[model samples]
Target: MNIHKISAATIARTACLLLALTNQLLSACGKPVLPIESQTVEQLVTAGITTVAALVSWWNNNSFTAAAIQADAEYARLKQKGE
Candidate 1:
């Protein structure tokens, strides 16, 4: 019966429907257009090595970040204890 309530509900429902349609379209478009052939054993091994190196680099960076976080937390705890 209230015009404001009706307009707000309509807008909310339209937004939700649009978001769902957009997600569906995006997912559908994300598939590769062409089929890929299987790689040779040598190619697979090289790819595996590359992946491992990348993972190791990521782990090193993450370890540095984690260590920094721990150091910061310890510093904060000590500051609080002193105060």
Candidate 2:
């Protein structure tokens, strides 16, 4: 084989061996290679506050409260007519 061909083959074989060794090492450790991104305390607190506010607003605007108020007004009207 030519000198250039021999050198290229050597580099290719070395790269493949390195890749296999790295994979084996990673598997043996039983952990992920990449780091996980973590949320900040401020972000968690803000999310909790936003969730609570949304729930409260939804409850206030729900049909049950509106229906109750409407029933009370109707009852008042009936009482006025009876009087």
Candidate 3:
């Protein structure tokens, strides 16, 4: 058997990348209309904000929240309002 350990930063970055790709893929004809560079930048920003918010919440409540989940919900809300 083989085993590997990944750091939290790596996991967070990977999760953000996957989220961005999935969002793009599901948006238009199974294709990404936006450039890959922009998608990456946007995802990184979202990841950074979510990380900060999660850390603040953890510091206050001693619990961690799922960043991707909240991001998706917020995205949907924004989209519905045509923002």
In order, candidate lDDTs are: 0.74, 0.75, 0.80
Q: Evaluated with lDDT, which candidate comes out highest?
A: 3
Worst 10 residues of 2 by lDDT: 32-41
TM-score of each: 0.30, 0.30, 0.32
Ranking by TM-score: 3, 2, 1
Can you write out model 2's per-residue Cα lDDT over 1-83, one digit (the tens) per residue? 65544588899999899877776688579753432335664787889999999999987734468788898788789999995
Better of 2 and 3 by TM-score: 3
Scored by Cα lDDT, where does model 1 land?
A: 0.74
User: Cα-based RMSD of the predictions, in order?
Assistant: 11.8, 21.6, 19.0
Which is better, 1 or 3, measured by lDDT? Answer: 3
Question: Which candidate has the top score in TM-score?
Answer: 3
lDDT of 3 at 18: 90
Candidate 2 residue 62 Cα shift, in angstroms, is 6.0
Error of 2 at 65 (Å): 14
lDDT of 3 by residue, 6-41 (tens): 999999999899987777777656666554677888
